[model samples]
Structures are given as C-alpha cells and as structure tokens.
Target: MGRVGKQTIVFKNPPVISCAYSSVGPKEAAGPLSTYFDHSYEDELLGQDTWEKAESKLIENTIQGLLTRSGKNPTDIEFIFAGDLENQIVASTFGVSSFNIPYFGLYGACSTMGESLCLASMAIGGGMAQTVIAGTSSHYCAAEKQFRYPLEYAGQRTLTQQWTVTGSGYVLVTHGGKGPQVEAITPGKIVDLGISDTFNMGAAMAPAAIDTIVTHLEDTGRRPCDFDAIITGDLGNCGVDIAITLAHKLGYDLKGILNDCGKMIFDNEKQDTHSGGSGCGCSASVFTGYLYKQLLEGKLKRILLVPTGALMSPTSGFQGNTIPGIAHAVSIVMK
Candidate 1:
C-alpha cells in the first residue's frame, strides 16, 4: 500500500471481496431491495428476549452466512473486524467472540461499515492477514432506546429524524479471490459543523459526507463521473439533498452518479421512515446485499462507497454538545 495523498491510500495489491452476507429485520424485508438479503427475520427479537441480543444474533448469523457462502470455515478467516451502534460495541464483541477468530472491534457509528472494510482491505494489501471479515450491525429498538428514548415512551419523531435499521451485514475480504477489488481507501477527518440537534442526524452528517467526497476526488485526481455510482452510507433524504447542493456549490457535479444507501434501502414514502434509514446496518446491508451482487454480476464496473457517520454520545447530547461528523471512502472496482 502506498499513500496517494494526505487522506487517500492506493493499494499496490488490492484485496478482493470474495463474498458477502446480510440479515435484516421484517421492516427491511419489506423494502425494495429485500430480495437481495441472505435472510430476513419476521421477528425482530430472533427468539431472543432483548433487542440487544437480537442484534448480536443478527451479526452472528450474517458472519456465519458469509462463511457458508464463501465455502470457508471460521478457522480460515484471519481476522474479524466488526462493530455496532451500541455502548462499547457489545453486540459485535458478544456476537463474534464464539468464532475464536482474531477480532478487532470498531466504532464509527453508522460509518463503522466503511471503516471496517477499509481496515480489512489494508490488512490484506499490507500482508498482515490473508483474509478478514468486515461487518457491522444495528437494531431499531436497541439504538432508539440507547440514543434517544425507550419504545415504551412512544417518543415523537420529527420529520428530519431517521429510522434505525434492524440488521447486520458481513463481507469476506481475501488476498486472491474472484470478486470486486478494493482499489483505494480515503479515511475522513472529523468535520463538525456545530449542529447540536441529535434528532436531525442527516443534517449533522451531510457536510462531513461532502467534505470526504471532495477530499477523495482531489487526492485521487479522479472526477466524480469516473465511478458508476458514488454512494454514501446512511445520509437519508435530508443529508443527500444537502450533500448534492453543497457539492454543486463547490464546483462538483454529482448529477446521476450520486446515490445514498439510506434512501435506497427503504421506500421512504410508503415505509413512513420520515427522512430515511440511518444506522450501522443501513449501509452494511445495502452494500453487501445489493451493491456487491451488482458488481459481481458486471452491472457496475466501478463504485465509490462512502459511509457517513455522526460522532455523538448520549452523554454528550445530554450535556448540550454539538455533534461531530465523519465519513470514509472505499473505491471498489470489478475487472
């Protein structure tokens, strides 16, 4: 791996995404891309008593599913990098611990998907590991209760608020594989616009998404038109609009190339997901299930996947602190 610019890394030997798996809840199962997912549970609890354990089950199922799909055993995976939208990323830890694989737990809120992928690719490209599992999970009830209010409270949601997705997605990155390759990675810097409204996460994270995209383009000397699609993680309808307008003002035209996973995962109008979906699972499931399949099918030759995240803690919000935002870009190409 070699550093292309300040923020971007161009891999000398790119890692291939051998296989992927996604497990989503019933609400996501009813979404437009429902057929793409490996499994969808009608019961959000997944036979577990608590929402948190259900989320852990989602991650565990997806990881196991990825191994099964790839025709690989748990012992074959060199490392497992996973995270979730929970305190200390307990879900990922508890979910993946049984596999006995070397694990690295990550946390970037919704952007953990991209963060984990980028690191896993680096591990392969740098010869630190032959294969790695990168994944993330999130639950609607678990995240809602931890971040905002309990379901019992029946909290009122604003139009700008986004619905947390209940699901998990995992991808297997290997040194030599027949799949799309991770060509480059652009790690984002924290960009806080001093927005304190926790409910409007899309608004808080839009600028960060735009900033990271701009930096990636500049660092790689590649135009936005180069990729078949420039996809952002969990920036819902509001954030997508904001990012487009901001990019336009900054002399970047993201006309037909730009798409958002948050918006793509759900039918916002019919689903009543006010703005759209926003969670670690939002981008994870969509990319692994939908985008990866499209790449493998030769429908898309190149894609710039940028997962956006809001850096906010429940304590920080209660303390009246502004929300900081971040994003990371991973360039995937099929040859």
Candidate 2:
C-alpha cells in the first residue's frame, strides 16, 4: 500500500450489558406488599449503625448477582467504579474491597448513576480498558441520619421533603467483543432555574429534568414518540406533576409515556411514600432490576432514562439558600 492510502481496523465484537442490584431493610416493613418502599435500614436502629456496613453489604451482593448472572469472574473485571452518599464515601470504600478490582470512587449526589455511566462509557470508548464495573448506592437510615435525623425521631417534615431509600445498584461495561455496549448518552447539561427551596427537592429537580429532556430531544432530533418510554428519577408526586406541566408547555404530550420511579415503586395511600421519590438507589434499582429485565424480555425496545438530582448541602439550607437541581439522560436500545 502507498502512503496515499491508509487502512483502519475496528473491533468486530462489542461489549454486552449486564447489571446487578440489592436492597436492605424489611421488604414488608412499610406494609403488606411494601417491600420496595422501605429502604435498607428501615429495620435497623438509627444511631447504632454505620453506613459502611450496609453499603458494603448491598454493593457486595449486587456485584455477586452480576457475576453470577453474566457468568464472569471478578478477576476478569478490569476496573470497578462505585460511589454512595455516605460521609467520606464509607459505603463505596468497603463495597469495592470485596471485589478487589482496581477502581475509582465517585460522587454526584442523586445523579450518581448518570454520572457514573457517562464516565464508564467514555472509558470504554477511549480503549482505556476492556471491562469496567460502575454502580452507586444509598441507604435511607444512613442518609437520613447524616442529612437530617433518625426516622425513629419522627420529626416533622417540611412540604419540600423527600424520603431517601436504602439500596445499591451496579452495572458492568466492557470493551468491544464482550459485554453490552453503551448505545448513547445525552450528556447532562446543567440547567439552573434559580430555585432556592432546599426542603422541596422534587420541585427543585423538576425544572432541571424538563430542561434536559428538551435539550436532549433537540440535540438528537428525536421526537417524543421516537422512544417507547420516558422515565425519571425520584421526582415523587409533586415533582412528577411539575414535570408533566412543564413538558406540556414544551409541546410534547407525555401523559401516558412518562413515569417516575418514585411514584411507581409504592402505592401512595398504602405505603405513605409521602411526596414520592428519593435516593440514588431509587431509580438505579428500578431501572436496572425491573426495566432492564423487561427490555431484555422484549417488553421494551427503546427507552430513555433521565435521572435527576437536587444538589444542596445542609450548610446551603442553613444559609437561606435553595436547592439546585441537575439531570442526565441515557438512551438504551434493545434492537
């Protein structure tokens, strides 16, 4: 071949998608058929526990599930990336230890799933590794104790409150010729509505989801009908309504296609989920465990998942600042 001509080679086989997840606490603590409502620690004593214990257990269980399902050995995994909302990343640290896979820890509030997926996809695309594992977890009791107080305290919650759930979710991403390849990722664009209500995270995150979905549609030139379903993270009841209204103003009719994980997981009247969605585990578990399974079963062909997060700190609230929200989108394809 002359210098005028050049040749390129590409991998013939691509990575396959595999996921594993776990949740703690009593499956029926909230009530009959309320297994999904209660987070990991609803059955535990508040102040007497540490986030590391539960977080590690959940992560370990999730990874084990994935390994078993995919029939892959832990040693074959090239890297592991994990995170949680615990102080000093206690859960992630202990959780990754059991696998003994080389990895990095990450944090991006409730939007951890989207953030982690973005990074993992980029890593695989760049050929930095052949296989990678990414996941995030959150515990209701741990988060509540750190962010507010123990549930046993029974403190009055403000109208802007969101109930955190305890659970862990994990996904395995590998290079070409191996695992489920990442199809597409709509990088989360930061959209600030200038909202200042920390107590009401549902409202704070609603606008961000709206902004992201609109931008994603615009950028990809996709219409609402292009995808089979559009799902959101823990927006709860109030946020879901806000999302519907804003989406209507955008000229997209999502009345039937739109759903929120927070609202779908529990029966509001029976479980008393209160205001509806919360926690990293909320969307992660539902998406990976439930939705993913459905897709694999031919129930869904194309799906869009937009996970939202309210980025607020205790100091920000005390300083009279409102919570800011962010959202990221990941488009999945089965065909």
Candidate 3:
C-alpha cells in the first residue's frame, strides 16, 4: 500500500507483543470467562450508587489486568487516552486517577475504540510519543440513564433495540518499537445511509456499516472473504441482519462470515442479550479480551473490526428525528 502521508515517526524497535488484555466481570458471567457483570451493587435508580461506582471499578479492574498481564509498572506508560459515555466522563476520570497515568479523555459514543486507536496510531506514527495507552468503557446503567430512561422505568424496547453491556474494554497501543506495529489503519470513512430513526439504532447503523465496508474494500482492494472475520461493534441481531442484506445488495456474501460483538458476548437464552449488546465497553472488551487472544492463538489471521455508533442526541430524539449512525473499521493482521 502507498504511504498515506509523510512518515513523521519511525520506530527504532517496534513494540512487540508483551500482553494484550484483562477482563473483570460478574461471577458466572454469561458467555465467556472473560466477560464480567457488576453485581457489587444492585439498584433501580438512575444515577444511583452502582452506576457511579461500577464505572470507576471497571476502569480500575481493566488497568490492573493490563498491568498484571504485561508485568509493566504504571509509571512506564507515557499517556492514557480513555473515554466513556457518562456525563462529564466521570468513570474514565476516576479510573485513570486510580492508576495515576497522565492522559487525555474522549467520547464518540460506540465509535470510541476506533477513535482512540486512530489517535494512538498517529501519535506513534508521528514519533510524538513512545508509549501510550488507549481505551474506552461503558456501563449499561450509566448509558441507559444518560441516553434513555432507567431500566426500572420499564421502557419498552423494540426489536431494533440494542442492549448495553455493563463493562469496560482497554487496549495498550505503544510506540511501534515496543509492541505490535500498527500494520494498517483504514481510517473510517463516514457514509450516511440517509437513515433516520431513533427508535431503531440497528437500522441506522446498518447503512454506515455498509458504507464503511464498501469503502474499505475499495481502498484496500480486498474482498469480504479476504479477512478471517468481519466483526461489527454493537450492531446486535437486527443490525447484523441489515448489514448482511446490504452486503448482498452490494454483491458481497457476508451471511455466515460476519459476527457482532453484541451477539457473541452472551448467550441469548441465558443472558437475554436482547437484540444484542451496545455500549462503548461491548466492542472494546470483546476486541481486547476475546479477539486479541484469538489472534495470539492462531485461530484468526486477518480480521476486520468495525465499531458502530448511533449518533442520536437527546435533542435529536426530542425533535423526533431519526438517529444517524457511524462506523469505523480497524483491520488487524497477525503474522
């Protein structure tokens, strides 16, 4: 592939794989041992105790796992770029404070993971930083209250609804010399499918997925089967179906090949993950905890991870406008 731009940064000793991730979850978590639930506190109120504490605890647990797995001291990290969906980013702030790592905060709803990776790669590619950590987290309770009503409020969710995951996901992207060099970053090309429906995020995000996938294939000159897996962040069940339909329309077959984090993270009967899982933490946790390990184990070679976000604000919802969606793709290859 041709260089996208001037190579301002070069790694003297590209970062190699030391350790990838760590997960903390509720005991007897649904799908994977890596998955966790916050049972520390159970409350029906929005902005209650569990929501507040879970966010910070999720971050703390995630950082601790990363440190323990990598066997690196917190002081070794140069910076931390973390984000969450809570108001004023309270969870991320508290989580980072516990580790005491200097960092930047961000928010992109469900697209946070891709956003963080893009920025981290740039910092490493530009020689601006040697070691940086980027991660995003979301709590089901926190997000629900902020974006919708409290669960106790018993708001009916439609088939197109996406259930939020109560967890956190983090990735340690260091300078190329220290870990796996970022091989390629197909910056997410925003493609609006001209959809509008706050009630059905799955519908909104499907077009964005189609747009990104089509553009990415064109840009890289690769086909759908070229990758071992095509993963979408929070498309859930309905969105996955829509994406598949869209792919077929574009002359691509993604039926059995596509996977959604929301669907994979929990068993339908046991967890009732409902349409599927959303939240910043859903994709983040799955990528770092499940997908990264799969790559290390040789089960997957090249993978396309696309994190989708419904860009409907409260104002937009109030105005009765449909939710606009966006998706960003990060291609990961194991050699």
Tell me the number of clashing residue pairs for each predicted model.
Answer: 0, 15, 17
**Tens digit of per-residue lDDT, candidate 2, span 171-251:** 877765532345666656566677776657788888888887777777666787888888888888888889989999989
Models sorted by TM-score, best on top: 1, 3, 2
**lDDT comparison, 1 vs 3, better candidate:** 1
For candidate 2, the 10 contiguous residues with the lowest summed lDDT are: 1-10
State the lDDT at 238 in candidate 2: 88
Please provide, for model 1 over 1-335, each residue's C-alpha lDDT reduced to its tens digit, 9 standing for 90 to 100. 79987789999899999899999999999999989988999999999999999999888889999998889899998999999999999999889988999999999999999999999999999999998999998999999999999999998899999999998899999998789999999988999999999989988898999999999999999999999999999889888998999999999999788999999989999999998998999999999989999999999999999999999999999899999999999999999
Off by over 4 Å in 1: none
Give the per-residue lDDT of model 3 (tens digit) for 172-254.
77654333345555555455566666656777888887777777777666788998999998888888999999999999899
Q: Judged by lDDT against the true structure, how good is candidate 2?
A: 0.70
lDDT of each: 0.93, 0.70, 0.71
For TM-score, the strongest prediction is 1
Order the candidates by lDDT, highest first.
1, 3, 2
For each candidate, give its TM-score against the true structure: 0.99, 0.86, 0.86
